[model samples]
Target: MAMPEYTDGVLELYEITNDESEDYPEERLKYTGLRIWYRELAVYDTTRAKLSADSVEVTYKLAIPQYKKINSKCICLIDGEQHEIYNIAHTTTKDGFKESELTLKTPAYEREVIDDTERTE
Candidate 1:
């Protein structure tokens, strides 16, 4: 879908990245919080997810390096909880901005992170 003319850009992303080093398995995962603009999407049933079957669209300025870094395997922290980015829909706006509609593997509700120290990856 095409992005709107303007976005308030209030949402945020955890932007997880793996180190890909076999030697340091413990420290192989990394996380980067990314500011984003998102709107709620319809929730549905999906047997694929171990968590809640919910998703959200993460629209934002299409950026490279970081944009190139994201894929189906990538996961991000939403409110400090882990959520998988199952799909990515990229769009170029009329005024020249990049947008990403990121679908997740879990419910977008109750995303509140209880403890930051509980993160394993």
Candidate 2:
């Protein structure tokens, strides 16, 4: 029983990969340009209420290709909102697809550092 309502939303999948830049070699997170199915697990305000400051929680269902690499650092964007991916467990697999249970939430925003090095002696 496929629900059309749940498939209405689009999920932008992003993956973490190593950037081999000569000067700024680091892990780079970029979108794989893959669109997957996205749906909220719970629509009630209870989930949003329990969220931490500036954090929005949502669960999405998606089937990823086996060739694509996915890690904890992967990012998911839905409805112009970005989310941090947690432990991705496969719910099902068939036809070279991995159905992952991707529950995401907004990561805690880091506050700007206050430079207090100048001491008034």
Candidate 3:
């Protein structure tokens, strides 16, 4: 079932901030708190020099909207799989980070279609 979109609902969705602020104070340099979905979370292994990690700790970049609760977990999708994330570590950059960076493995998929062209030869 799909929930109706809030037309008048005053619920503030979460979002992550990445743009650099010059006039804005450092403390107010937009931080990603909510509005982040899990599947959108990009996953990678933190390693010294290897590609994989024995234990994985995921990281997410999300946008936080002003006037919303800061303690809500967003549903994450990993390679078409769904996941729930309650706590997400926050990071900021000159250009905001995307939520697609917290998966155990990278996402990849493909589709196959049969050719329907008739051969004249």
* Candidate with the greatest lDDT versus the true structure: 2
Tens digits of per-residue lDDT for model 3, 1-89: 33222232121122223335556522111222223322233333334224335332333333332222343232333233433343444
- What are the candidates' C-alpha RMSDs? 8.5, 11.8, 20.9
Best by TM-score: 2
- Worst ten in a row by lDDT for model 2: 110-119
lDDT of 1: 0.45
Q: What is candidate 2's lDDT per residue for 5-115, written digit by digit as tens?
A: 335566666665665755766554565666666544543566446653445554543434332356666776676666677546665433343455565655443222122
- Better by lDDT, candidate 2 or 1: 2
Cα displacement (angstroms), candidate 1, residue 87, comes to 1.2
User: Which residue ranges in model 3 land beyond 4 Å of their true spot?
Assistant: 1-45, 48-54, 57-73, 95-121
lDDT, model 2, position 65: 32
The lDDT values for all models are: 0.45, 0.52, 0.30
**Native-to-model Cα distance after best TM-score fit, residue 44 in candidate 2, in Å:** 10
Count of residue pairs whose backbone atoms collide, per candidate: 2, 0, 26
In the predicted model 1, the residue pairs found to clash are 14-77, 62-98
Residue 116 of model 3: what lDDT? Answer: 16
In angstroms, the error of model 2 at 107 is 2.5
**Residue 66 alpha-carbon offset, candidate 2, angstroms:** 9.2
